[model samples]
Target: MHKPLLTTDFLDRARRHYADEEAVLAVDGTRYTYAELGERADRFSAALQARGIEKGDRVAVLDPNTHYHLEAAYGAMQVGAVHTPLNYRLTPDDFSYMLSDAGVDAIYADAEYAANVEAIRDEVPTETFLTNDADAVEGDWESFDAALDDADPDAYERPEMDEDEVITINYTSGTTGDPKGVCRTHRAETLHAYLISIHQEITDDDVYLWTLPMFHVNGWGHIYAITGAGARHVCTRGVDVAETFDRIRGEDISYFCAAPTVLNMLGDHHAEHGGATTGDNDVRVATAGAAPPEATIRTVEEEFGWELKHVYGATETGPLITTSDAKRHFDEGADDRFAVKKTQGIGYLGTEVRVVDEDGEDVAADGETIGEIVVRGNQVMDRYWNKPEATEEAFSERLEGYYHMGDLAVVDEDGFVSIQDRKKDIIISGGENISSIELEDTLFEHDVVSDVAVIPAPDERWGETPKAFVVPESGDPDDAGATPEELKAFVRDRVADYKTPGEVEFVAELPTTATGKIQKYELREREWDEEDRMVGEG
Candidate 1:
């Protein structure tokens, strides 16, 4: 017998089998069992129904990595409403656009971020507004806890849902333009959770730390995977290096996900504090957003004694179609393993990842020929909500039926996919292709460089030359400890002379997204602002 794989099945399973077990350790130190969490979700579902929210209606959630996010999301999905999560770091304008575009019926905003929503109350279609602390917010928002307390848990009836029905609408980061809502079916989400559970090695006994935001691709789909595994979630409002270490030690966190920038921050904190950052438990950290340099990976695995799994994908592709955790390729604790883990690696089970050329043919496995990465997987998003042209363009650009990732990569002889740079971020200087990622990675190896971003700057002679933005270890550009010429010579000695950065600017820190990925587009915009057109264009 085939059963529909609904997203609500995860919470139902946790409530059934792990009812009395600890489900969530809230940021404020409140402990909740699966039974309690499930009941809370049910009450929220009742509250939403009382507010006139029905099946297929959009319910937006704007919060940090708190327990409220999980409750709100599961509550919305339990009643078959579309679970729409918003980045708390976004501006009022961003929320206005997303809420209006999604036609959100109700929204649960965290007390800290409710002001943003309040600022745009008149612009959106939402009528029901709730916040964790109604007293803290200066608006007509109701208390989330008060609503739950007033509602009966058994009053709401769950509508029948099919696996093909859209249940979640994740908004893109909108780096290039207005954010588009990515429509994902219950099948896509359920299958993605299962894939991550197998690849991430999540277990019932594991304790998961929430360093990654729940707003990002549903915390890379961990909200369901960890819950379905009967694991314990250790929630936090935000990531702090010291707090991360403390939670790992105190709570015995076995697994967590973070961007490479967060790993770098932890590494720096560990370096300054010595062995105090280590916990008694063996930790497994899954990192993405960008490939971690070999040096950063070495620090995480060798020094911190944690397993580092580098995965890759975009928000439109389940954000986790590929992983570098394949054990058959390299021996544990070997120096060569870092090189293997440095690549995006092979695709997950049942996922088809390919590096294709302009003609949609697979590139040679020479690790030198750069091509765009395309994927066909059950976990990929179905389409962009209300944007038919963009949806068609995404899947039909490189290969029909396969989603184009817009990332340039290469495959080694062993079929490991290694990303080089974004399609638009690749620098073309004097008829030569230069990967900004390669340049940044090289600069990251320098002793004085704490963080770095590389972009193509407009050059009169070469059309476009690489420029480096370096965040020094001293945190001050004037006292960076290394001259620009010395850094230029350093890269010149390691890579091809032409690939060396033509200009180097030291900064306090590189601009990063809410998820800790550096915003290279911001740097590119600054460099090409005066130019009429970007390089490699007529």
Candidate 2:
């Protein structure tokens, strides 16, 4: 006999085997056992049922990295409702568009962010509003704990679900247009969780810190993977460098995921205030969102004494189809190891990652031939929600069945993929292709640069030239230790002359998304606002 491979199986298994074990450490220091967590989820399911939420209805969750997000997500999935997570950093207008687009029936927004939802409550189709702290919110939102307390845990029924049923909808960042909901099935999520469990090396004794947003692809599927493994979830409000170190040493955190920017924050903090970055537990950190500079990876591995696993994927994919944890490739020298780890290593067990040209043919594996990265696997999204045209365009871009990642990359002979830049972020100057990632990576090596974003600035002579916005280490642009000409000469000595930034401006900080990825499009918009059309565009 075969199982249906539903996402609910994860929590069910944990409840059956590890019910008495500590399941989650809430942000406020409250600890809940698996049995307690499971009951809370069951109560949430009952409450949703009582509130007229049915199977297939969309239930949105808006919260930081907290236990409530896990409970709300599992509760909705337990009763066969679609779990739709919203980015807490989004504006009220963004929430309005997503909630209205998804036709969300009910929503659980954290008290801090519920006001955004409340601001647009009149425009959405949602009826039930729930918040973790109703007293702090300004609307008629019910307290989540109160709902669970009043609910009869056994009153809800679990509907029969198929493996192919779309159980979750994740929204893209909408940098180009309106955010599209990426539809994923039970089988897709279940398989993705399994893959991460294998690659991330999660175990029952591991303590996972929630530094990454739980809304990001369901914490990159760790919400299910960690729970299914019967591990511990140490919740947090967000990434606070000092608080993160305290948690690592206090709770003995074994594994966690963070964007490269968060890692940089930790590195910077360690440099300023020297202290123990790890405790008795051996730490492993998974980083993505961008290819971290080799310097960042070296700092993480050498100074912090932590294992760094660089992963790559998108919201449309499992958000984790590839990992750089291939130990077999690390048998070479230390420099070779960092070189291998710097690239997005081989695909997961069942994932097929390839670099293909415009015609869908495989690009040469010479490590210099650039092409688009496409993938096909069990964890890829089925389609976009309510947007058939966008769905068709995504899957049929350069290849038919594979999901286009929209990142241009090169593949090595050993199959390691190195992302050069986003398709639109590539700088075209004097008919030469310049990768902004390459330029930024070069700049990151300078002592005075804390962070950098390179964009195509319009030029009368070259059509468009590379311009870098640098965040100084001093946190004050005016006090930046290095001058623009000095930084320009620094890059000129490191890379090709054409790849060097023609102009450099110091900034106090760079704009980042909720997940800590740099918003390069904002920089591009500012640079090309006066131009009729961007260079190299049709």
Candidate 3:
């Protein structure tokens, strides 16, 4: 029998199986049961419908990870409305573009970002602005909680969800031009959640911490999987290393995912206190976007006493097509062990992965030949919203049938995938293709660089060259703490001389997008304004 894929159905199942079970734990230590979550979601859905939001309407949600965010998401999903989750850290301009492009009819924002919505609210297609309570700021918007206060608690009976009908329209972290909306359906989200659980080994016994924002690929598909498994959810509004550690101990958090920035913070916290004792910490950390450096991975395993699983995918790909936790045949301490942990492993069930040369021919899986990565599956997104040309560009211009990942990679004989570099981020210096990831990894080895981003610079003679934007660890910004020349020499000592940055720019901190990803495209624009192509898209 075919099981339902819509999230409301999963909520119904969860209510039946774990009605009194705790579904969400707030930061202040309040708990909401699965049954309560469903009722609250029903009230919110009724309130939304009262405001004229109906099936197929687009409702944009912008907030930190919280209990209400989950309720709003489930309510939106239940009504068959397209849920558009925005990065709460985005600028007014970023929000404006996404809202106008997605044709958002309503928006639910937290108080901290109410001004952001106000700045562009007139231009957006939305009038139903629902702001949640935070430190109060005056706005003419509806109170998020108060709206549900008077609404009927009775559950809504909307049209049944079609697996093929669009359920979400997630915007990518745009480093270059406007962000593209990746439209996904019920089948894709539900199927990908199952894949994430099996690959990450999540079950009912696990207690998940929401460190990753729910807006990103629906919390990377864990929202569905964890709910299905009847797991407990601990909600957090922000990431603080000490608070994270305390929660892991106090709440007994078993699984979570965050960017390497968050992981580094936790490692620093551990170093300040006594490091994690063996088998004392019972948490699993999964990271993605790009494979973090090997040292960061080893630190979590050795110091935090946690197993770090690395994977890679983009917003357009449903973000679970590749992972690195597949069972291995080799011994534990072998040199290849580090290599295997670094490579993005085989595809999830029902997904196909391949690497091909520029000519569209499959490359040998010898772990040496670098080529573009491609995938196609049921979990793949349906298409870009209102964008036929962009959708066409995504699936073609490289391969005939596969969705071109645009990331350059290679596969080993055992079917493990290693990212050589991004084809777009490569530096063409003196006619050499220098991998920016290689240079960034080597620079990270430097003791002075706290955080670093590598992009390309325009060269009159060479056409393009690598440029490093570095953030040093030393506290004072006026000390001339770490010079660009020093960083170049640091890289020169390790990698080939040609791979070194032609020039390094020192900054107090590296700029990151709302999602905690280093905004390489903004840095790329500063260095490559005169050139036709960016070293990385800024």
Report how far residue 522 has shifted in candidate 2, in Å. 16
> What is the number of backbone collisions in each predicted candidate, taken in the order shown?
0, 0, 2
Taking the tens digit of each residue's C-alpha lDDT, what string does model 1 give over 1-538?
9999999999999999999999999999999999999999999999999999999999999999999999999999999999999977666877999999999999999999999899999999999999999999998999999999999999999999999999999987533456789999999999999999999999999999999999888999999999999999999988798999999999999999977667777888888987554466789999876667677788988888899999988779997989999888999988889888988899999999999999899999999998999999999999999999999989999789999988888899989998765665666554344667778878988999999988888764455688999999999999999999999999887665777999999999888999999888778767767653343211
Q: What is the Å distance of residue 429 in model 2 from its true position?
A: 23
- The TM-score that candidate 2 achieves is 0.81
1-538 in candidate 3: lDDT tens per residue?
9766775666777888998999999776889999998888888888888888888899998988888788888888878889999877666777888999999998889888878888888888887988877347465788888888878867466777788889999987433345689999898888888788888888887889998888988888877888888888899987876778778887788899976556666766687886333333388889765455566677787667687787767677788788777646445645455566767788878889999998888899898898999998878899988889878987986797788887788899988888755555655453234667777877888888778888867654344568887777874445646677887888887665666788887788777988899887777666656643343211
Clashing pairs in 3: 521-537, 521-538
lDDT for each residue of candidate 2 in 420-503, tens digit (9 for 90 to 100)? 656656665543446677778889999999999988887654556889999999999999999999999999876656667989
Q: What are the Cα lDDT values of the candidates?
A: 0.88, 0.88, 0.77
TM accuracy, model 1? 0.81
In candidate 3, position 130 carries an lDDT of 88
Residue 516 miss distance in model 1 (angstroms):
34
